[model samples]
Each structure stands twice: as C-alpha cells, then as structure tokens.
Target: MLAKQRYNKILELLDKDGIVHTAELVKLMGVSSETVRKDLEYLDNQGRLSRVHGGAVPVDIGTTPDMPGGYISLQIRNSQHLEQKSAITAKAASMVEEGQIIALDYGSTSQMMALTLKERFHRLTVVTNSIQNALILAENPGITIILTGGVLNRDEYTLVNDFSATLESIHIDIMFMTVTGIDPVVGCTDQRLSEIRIQNQLHQSASRTIVLADSSKFGKASLIKICPFEEIDTIITDGGITPLMEEKIRKTGTRLIIS
Candidate 1:
C-alpha cells in the first residue's frame, strides 16, 4: 500500500477505537515497525494526531479554547484498565453518604465515581470541574451539582485555570481525586500545572481527601506533583494492587481500601 493510503487507514482505526498502538499498526499494515513509527511521526507533525508512549491519538479530543502555553492535548489512547477503574470507582462511591458535600476531580476514574454515586446517593452536593460528571448528575433531582467556572479543557472535559482558585472558599466533606500517576514516595501527580494547582487547593480545603486510582497509576510519575501520599486521607484501589504497594501506602499512615 502507498504511504498515503496506510496513513489514512491508521487514522481511520484511531477514530474508531480512540487509539492506535504501534505494534497493532505494524501488523495491520504488514509493515516494519520503523515504517509504522514514521507514519505516526508524520501524522503527528501534520497536527492530525498526537503520539503517546505506544500509540497515536486524535488531537482535537478534549481541546480547550483558551489553552495555556505549550499545552498539548491529553488523550488516553490505551483504555486497557477501564474495567479496573470502574471497579475502583464503585468501591469508592460506596463510602460516600447522603447529605455530604463531595469534591470530585476530573478524569475517567472520577467520571465513573460520579456515575455510581448518581445511582446510589440522594440529597448530596457534588462539586466538580468535569462537564461529563456534571451532566451525569444533572438528571438526578436528589443531587445538587456544582461545576467550577474556568476555561474548559476539551481533552478531559474539566475546568481549570484561575477559576479553580475559587474552590478555596468552599468547604467539602470529602474530595475524590484522580491522577495520571501516583508514587508511594512522591505522591499524586498530573501532567498539567493548572490541574496541579486546582488539586492542591481541593486537598487543602476538603475535610477528607480520598484518592481513587487503578494499579496502572502506581510507580508512574507525571510532570507535576499535586500532593504527597501523607496528605491523602484514604486510597481506594482495585484488587490488582500489589501487596507490597499496599504496605508502602500503609506505612504513610493513609488508610488503604482495596476492593
């Protein structure tokens, strides 16, 4: 196949699945790995796609109007652990009670939490920056949803920037946060500085901070550290979390709830 045909086909696959791994593309195109890599590089340069660790994702997804300087679109081309994220969210939502005010972070994991909570809880106030989360709760009359006002991040469907500073004025019973990476030593982290600032404020203002993450997040480090493990009041994860990891987290004196 011509290079142009192969490139267009790759994009077609990405549009259908939201991601295209290098190995998969190589096998599909019956081409060398180097050739696949070159195609991905070419697509990225053309602003047609964004290359991730092992794959390429669409660039326009979750793009914001007022994007900060040097801000690249954030997309998860690989959704390998989505099931695990749902499990973790389900377990975390079970901990919430009616009439409690909760602060929810943006991301797929927290989105699952919002969905679970919508079915389980009634008469609660939920504050979140995620447009998806807000819409999920909007259908329920028993839940009062508050969305943070800020520049909308289309990539993640969350609000960020100076408007996040407003979180400091409000009090919440619990904060359910999700991060791109979590280190037993370095704590929670995200790729964007604006997100880090908002997470920090939420951590400080909430009475309790609970981190909801899957095993894939463990040991990875992002560009910015939002909070240390000690600052986290509780961690809810799936059974895929290793025993050693649980021990390391426990040593920090943070409650670990494994589902």
Candidate 2:
C-alpha cells in the first residue's frame, strides 16, 4: 500500500496495543523490515510515537522533548519506563542493608524501590513523604513506615511540607531519592516547587543520598533545582546513560552506578 496508508495502519496498531513492533508491522503491512524501520523512524521524528529497540511506544505522556521536565501524573509516569526503573530500583534495593532506616522520596522510581525493598529486606524502617511508597511497604510487619507530615499533593501523591523539623530527630541511613531531571551541570531538579524544601531536608537527614534516576532523566534541567551534584553521594540509573554524561557525572565526585 501507499506510505500514508502504512502510517495510518501503524498508528492504529499503536493506539490499540500502546506499542507496535517492527516485525509485527512488517507482517501486517506486507512490507519489508527496512520499510517498517523507516516508517517507525518517520513517526518518531514527527513526534507521533517513540521508537524503541524492537518497537515503537506511545509518545511519552505529560512531557515534551524540548522541555524535558514537567509535571507528569504518577500513573502516567509509572507506566512509561518500566524496565529501566525496575532495573534501577532493583539496584537501589541491593544497596540497602538489613534493618537500616532508609528514606524514600516521592516518584515512580522510588515507589518501585519500595516494592524491591519490601521483597528483599525483612526488617527495616522506611521513612517517606510518598503515600504510595508508604502503602507499598505497609503490609510488611518487619518494615516500619514513617510518613513525613505535610500537605498532600494529590497529583503526585506526595506530601509537600517543610520536613526539616520532622527529620531533625530521625537518623536516615540512606535516602533513595528521585527527580524529574538530572543534569551533570544543573544537578537534580523536579517539576514541583513545593517539594524542594522537603527534598533538601531528606538530604540533610540521611547520612548518604542515593538518587534513583533513569537514563532518560539525564542531561535535562527541570523547572526548579533541588540540589547540586556535590550534595549527592551517588546516583543509580540504567545502562541507557551515555558515556560522556557518565564521565561528567563522575567528574562531579558523585558515584555513578549503572544497573
């Protein structure tokens, strides 16, 4: 068929399944694999879809490429980067020791880290400002959950209040934080302005801060700055991070762990 027909078909498949693979599209369209790849590339370039390794995924919802940082709903963000976030959080969970008081910040990655922590650790204390993370670990009898009292941010499901007083008495072994953006030069940033104070408090409360950011978050600066690279102890991300960015991160004296 014509290229326009092929493009329409690909979009139809993407809408139906949320993703479409090259091989599947080729078979459906009776087109060569090269033709399918070119089609996907065209859609990706036109901002209609995102081309992945074997397939094309729906354009990321709630954020644009030009402005890499924006307020994405928790549900939409959770479904966007499953593999990378899972790998990153699995690595984050591995860094935790038994019975340590760990602080978890609010985000999809931090929520996944909560699940990993629940599965891996038997006895531990989790301090968090995220309602979702708290609920995820609440069922574990051995895992103590502490919620930082703050105003509720319904969109993000995060509590936003000055946590300095609450965290003053709490000794956090490690803080597994998440951010909307991670730039080697700009440091860590988030779309929400209200959470900045709490984030800084979490940083000060923890003896060590381990940021859980996916590779997509690298090289971007969001609306507001949370902290600089010097304040972060380490960052855990997936293999998608670029070598040049990795080198830049390491040069800031912050450890980079690629999962």
Candidate 3:
C-alpha cells in the first residue's frame, strides 16, 4: 500500500477505537512492522497523532477559540478534570527545589501546585498574580508568598490587567503556568488577553517555563498563542498523553512528566 494510504487507514482506526497497536496495524495494513512504525513516526512528526507503547492513540481535542470563552469562574473550573489535575499538581510539586523562586499563574491546577509546594517545601519564595494562591500559601509560614499587584478578575479570583513591579523585578527560578489550550500547531494558548499579557511577561522573566495542563488540553488551541513548543521547558500532565505527543515533546527536548 502507498504510505499515504496507510497513514489514512491508521488515523481512521485511531478515530474509531482511539488507539492502534503495532501488531494490529501490521495485520490491518498488510505491511511489515518496520513499515508501520515508520508510518506512525511520520504521522507523529506531523502532529497528526500520538504514539504510545506498542500502539498509537488519537489526540483528544476541544474547540480552539477562533473566538473566545470569556473569563471562567473558579468554582466552575474546580469541577473539571479532577483526577487529571490532581496528578498534574503532584508531579509539578515533586520537581520543586526547597529554596528556588517559583512563579505560579492563576488556575485551579496552579492553586493545587502551590498547596503542594507549601506542604513539601521550606524557605521557598513564591510569587503569583492569583489571590487564591496568596491566600492558600499565606498560612504556611515556611513559605514566603509574594502577591503581584494587578487588577482583579473576580470570577476567577485572579489579579490581572495590570503589571506588577514585584513580578518584573525578580528572577523567577521556575514558573509553573496553566493554559486553556496545549496544541502542537498552536503551542500554549489562552482565551484572556489580559492574562496573556501577564503570561508573556512571566514567560520572559522566568528562567524555566513549565506548563501544568491535563490531557484534555492536548490538541486544543485558544485565542492567543503564548509560545511555541520549543519555548516551554517542561510539561507536567496526566498519563493520558498519547505516545505521539510524548515522542514529540521528547524530540523538542521538553521534559514530559506524565503523572
């Protein structure tokens, strides 16, 4: 069969069943294992699918805002991807060093990451633009929490639309950010213009940028593109990430942590 034909069949099977194993691909395509692997590798390189151990899976996706969803509420967001968020937060927290300066962007996942930092680290200097992050971390005397000055996004309990002198002045050791979309083509993206402005600044100031998102975010695009795949240093997400994506991320030299 032509390589293009095989690629189409591979994706077709993935769409129907969500995963295509190597053995199954060989059987279905009437091709050798080497030929199937090369086909999967080529498709993976194009960001058309994700490869996994012994198989490949479809990259689950949602609407990439050609428009916008507006600002979302904290209460509403909390109900989303509970297990995935928990796994992401745990993995993100594990990478923190005791005395490094960490910057957190506002999101439920970022909130959970901060709490984990508070529970695990001592003498840590943390900076953020989220009111929720400050309130949660303030109780931990061992952690020094710096609240960036900004205008309020009340629905999200986040401070945005203003630049912080505090944020610009410090050198962030590691910045943990969350986004509305995580796509191969679009990279990191957000729906809020104000948040995007702040995130751009944060991304610039931080030494290392690590995104905290769940599996649901993969292949989705949002309103504003934050950076390319190469710009991010790491992505800590749930184990639901596809092999193709894992391979893509690894190829970019971005550390992929699947919780």
lDDT against the true structure, per candidate, is 0.79, 0.83, 0.79
Query: Tens digits of per-residue lDDT for model 3 on 35-123?
Result: 99999899888998766656676554322233233333455467567888988888888878888999998877888887788788877
List, residue by residue over 1-259, the lDDT tens digit for candidate 1: 8999998999898776666778778888899999999999999999998777667767865233332212333344225467787788888888788899999888777777888899998789999888888999987899998888899876777788887666889999999998867887888887666666677777788999999888867766667778887788888888888888888888888888877
Off by over 4 Å in 1: 1-80
Question: Can you give the TM-score per candidate against the true fold?
Answer: 0.73, 0.75, 0.71
Top candidate when judged by lDDT against the true structure: 2
The candidate that achieves the highest TM-score relative to the unseen native structure: 2
RMSD of 2: 7.2
Off by over 4 Å in 2: 1-69
Give Cα distance to truth, residue 98, candidate 2, Å. Answer: 0.8
Location of the lowest summed lDDT over 10 successive residues in candidate 1: 62-71
Which portions of model 3 miss their true places by more than 4 Å?
Answer: 1-67
lDDT of 1 at 187: 84
lDDT of 2 by residue, 130-216 (tens): 899999998788999988888887777888876448688789999888987899889998877777778788889899999999897
- Give the CA lDDT, 0 to 100, for residue 55 in model 2: 72
Task: Name the lDDT of candidate 2.
Answer: 0.83
